[model samples]
Target: MPEMLIDYYKAIENSSAKMLEAARLKDWDEVVRCEGACAVLIEQLRYQSQQQELEPAQRKEKARIMQRILRNDAQIRVLAEPWLTQFEHLFEGQLQVMH
Candidate 1:
């Protein structure tokens, strides 16, 4: 596989680990944040894969796609914290009731 592909996969793996850890700790916020980060990374990888077939003349178009991917990733990361926090609270409440 290409170096880019490897790197992308590594990012996803790392993000998944983090998310799992957060879930184990019942840290809903962290889990959500990590998951969001993973999602963005995956989307970026998807975009990059699509650009791999483009011709040299389409460099600008590829750049635009990359830019959009990056922007979406950033946006997701920004919202991750709050979403995770909310998720954690809900999860905790449910767990408490189960006891």
Candidate 2:
């Protein structure tokens, strides 16, 4: 069978879930990997959307999936904030050392 637009939404949601899980585990590398997957999926989705569109029911499901993805992304940001801050500080130190 051919692929569907809803399937892309589901795959993106799944990737976001994985990203949240990896973030919770403090595995930033895995989170980054999942993020890359999400990015590729998003691009694929954009391309596929031009060719296919969801039915009314599928559109509803897509909305719900998007909500969940947003939730997962919010949680991931919350989990990664401290680490990002520290990473920024590390870069700052490097810049200082270079000067």
Candidate 3:
């Protein structure tokens, strides 16, 4: 809602896209870097979520935190889904090879 929150969401979305691209390319190093960035953002979001009282100034900060969390989650799922899919494909290929 707040501009700050919108910024965080944008950052998360960008980072997630990078991570997904890295995974899709099988670039483990890039994936790790993206994952680390996501972890830091997630921590910041968790801290903001714990604050009980938010002032008007803090509203943007809180919104940014929430956005970061949501985007991070979506990014993680994106990264994981491809990995799972790839693994299944590889496993099936191995099975066929064995046969």
Candidate 4:
């Protein structure tokens, strides 16, 4: 396909959407798994991007896909705040004990 680059972006977006759903469900393990998948997709996208360029129309579509991914990421972060705080506290406690 001429727009294989766009396909990569779409795949990343889909993974991000799944991550968002997992975050909503408070399924941290699932979110982590999805995050790993997203990292792989992002690496693949980066490699593919270096090898190919998107057409002007595909570039626009890519921008839209990126916006949605960012939106999903923002929401996921918001949802994870409580968990992050707890994790930070755990680390802080361990640090205090070590000291």
Overall lDDT per candidate, in order of appearance: 0.66, 0.93, 0.67, 0.92
What candidate 1 gets wrong by more than 4 Å, as runs, is: 1-3, 53-99
Q: Output the better candidate (2/4) by TM-score.
A: 2
Taking the tens digit of each residue's C-alpha lDDT, what string does model 4 give over 24-83? 999999999999988988888888899999999999999999999999999999999999
State the lDDT of candidate 1 residue by residue for 1-99, as single tens digits. 324544565667667667656655667688778878988988887887776554554555546555654654464555455766786998997899999
Which prediction has more favorable lDDT, 2 or 3?
2
Estimate, for each residue in 4-97, the C-alpha lDDT of model 2 and write its tens digit: 8899999999999999999999999999999999889989999999999799999899999999999999999999999999999989978998
Measured by TM-score, the strongest candidate is 2
Mind giving the per-residue lDDT tens digits that candidate 3 earns over 46-96?
565465445676577657656755675576577678777887998997899
Write the candidate numbers in order of decreasing TM-score.
2, 4, 1, 3
Question: Candidate 3: global Cα-lDDT?
Answer: 0.67
Give residue 86's lDDT in candidate 2 (0 to 100).
94
Error of 4 at 64 (Å): 0.5
Cand. 1 TM to true fold: 0.49
> Clashing residue pairs, candidate 1?
29-84, 29-85
Model 1: lDDT equals 0.66
